[model samples]
Target chain A: MRRSMLFIPGNTPNLLMNGDVLGSDAIILDLEDAVSPAEKDSARILVRNALKHLHYKGCEIIIRINPVDTEYWQKDLEEVIPLKPNLIMPPKVSCAQDVKTVSDYIAKLEEKCGFEKNTVKLIPLIETAMGVENAFQIAGADERVAAMFLGGEDLTADLRCKRTKEGNEIFYARTRLVCAARACGIDVYDTPFTDVDDLDGLYKDAQFAKSLGFTGKASISPRHVEGINEVFSPTQAEIDYAHEVMETIRIAKEQGKGVVSLRGKMIDAPIVERARQVIEMEKAMFGGVEDDE
Target chain B: MKITANAVAGTLESSDVYVKVEPCDTLEIEIESVVYNQFADDIKASVKEVLDELGVESGRISINDKGAIDCVIQARVETAIKRAGGNK
Candidate 1:
């Protein structure tokens, strides 16, 4: 249900106070790139306090800690893990070992805090060339991995290529991540469309990601949340078709028939599954409203 | 705990508080908040709460608040004290 995960700078109190009202399905409190080195300690404390006191209604809380290679990451984990955010996005994860390292550390922290084991899930940011190459292994590395996230900006940088607005360069990475996450039976998210002002471009990019089977898209700007949500949400036509498909299957089942057909075309298992997915998405987005009889 | 050095945390941004801690023989807190008339006592109480939790006995604590709430005040004060290297 994470259609749009908006990144909020960890140290900015103004944004943190109003995060819940921003219309994003999830909000990433960014502690990695958003906060300067000097402010890292301060930002950690601030984020910790915000999590403890503030209630972010109806949005998944994700804390994007610094990469595992840095000195700041462990401190970041120690501070936020106790507060129990919905997910922790480890940036620049390169392989299965990296995911293991974070996961193992979290397991220990969860135990030490007297919380349930694996209470905090991970969404690894596969941003580097090595990460993309080992995306499958990384996604399957630990049971704590709830999803995978593509970092196009860092991936392109690692690939020594210019990241154009058209995203011709990242097409392969996007598809590869989708395949890898799908193989692991986990959700995958696309990177933020960095050009915040271009709504048309955002829509196109979101649609492209959706077509490639991305579960959702991340956004650095609040302006893109509505558009991303719209792109990922099931359309009225799709909802209606899914309802018709389900109705057709119900009638066929009542007739004790092994075969089912919809609109003169055979409706097989794959089609039925797709229809259920569409219906599920519709319910999640629209509060499980019953279809018109 | 004793404040070992001068340290500052937070910023003068809106909905935030800038906190500074310095070594002193007696604990003293000075606050200048945008909402001083309404929430100054609550802000002071928040600062004292963090200071007491950190076992801070003596320091010159100064705060420049820009309409920050209790949690923010507590966080900034705690951060400033920790950055000051309080000897536990």
Candidate 2:
């Protein structure tokens, strides 16, 4: 149910302390690109202490550790593992073996630290062309992988294509990731909209992501959270239509009919099932009612 | 155990403390806190409690405090002592 996942730099003390009030469904304490090499150690210590002491109001805490190719990632894991963040996002994940290597490392750490096995979830960032080619295998690499994040900026760089406001360059990459994630029954997230000042553009991009079947979007700033959440949530009209389709299908089932008609439209099994999914998504997004029937 | 080397822990950030431990013949403390006039005594007592718990008999523990809470202060001091004693 993560509509917006915000990235907060791990080196900034003020932002780390104020993370709980930011209103994002999840917070990513970034220890990689946001932190300078000189400040890497300090950021790791700060993030570790924050995870041990601070509470983000039950928001999922995700630590974007340094990439696996660096010396800092091992230390990052050693310090951050004991505290147990909700998810660990590995950057530059170029293949399925990358996911497996990290998963194995986490498994060993969990055993040594006496933590419940498989408690830590992984959401790997697919940022390269190699990663895009192997998206399906990466998505199904491990049981702990709950989602795949498509990183557009880096992917465009890997493709040597220019990034434009219209997002035409990333269409193929995003579409591929969506299909791969859906095939594995896991969620997929879009990269942060880099133009922080363009609210209109952000809205358009979020709407496009939603249409492309992204469950949520990653945000670089706090202001983008509300917009992303709204774009991904099922609208009131959509909820009403879904309920109508469900009711019609239920009546048809009682009458021993294999098909149903709603407003002169043929409602088959797949259409009704999609409607049921929409209703369920609405409930998950705004949880006030329970499905007893 | 006696602190035989210069060791440090924590940082001088908000809600954190930078602790440095040096070998000395007797227990010595130098605390520089933002709230020196208000919570100086309490801060010193907290550091002393942690030092005693670590069985540190002699060391010069320098604390550069930035409004860190009691638990953070204790953790910083304990980490500094362990680093100085080579036990961590």
**In model 2, how well does chain A match by TM-score?**
0.94
Residue A216 CA error for candidate 1 (Å)?
A: 0.6
What's the C-alpha lDDT at position A225 in model 1? Answer: 94
Cα lDDT tens digits for candidate 1, B6-84: 9998889899999999999988999898999998899889899988888889999999999988888888888889889
**Candidate 2, backbone clash total:** 0
Off by over 4 Å in 2: B1-27, B37-61, B68-88
The sequence of per-residue lDDT tens digits that candidate 2 reaches over residues A1-293 is 67789999986766888887887889999999999886676677678877887777858898999888998887888888998888999999999999988989998998999999988999999999999999999999999999999998989999999988889999998999999999999999998999999999999999999999999999999988889888988889988888888778777778999867898999987787778777788877677755524
Error of 1 at A63 (Å): 0.7
Candidate 2: TM-score? 0.86
lDDT string, candidate 2, B1-88, tens digits: 7898998877787877888999999888999999889988999999999888878889899999998876567767876787688765
TM-score for candidate 1, residues paired by index: 0.98
**Least well predicted 10-residue stretch by lDDT in candidate 1 chain A:** A284-293
The parts of candidate 1 lying over 4 Å away from their true place are A290-293, B86-88
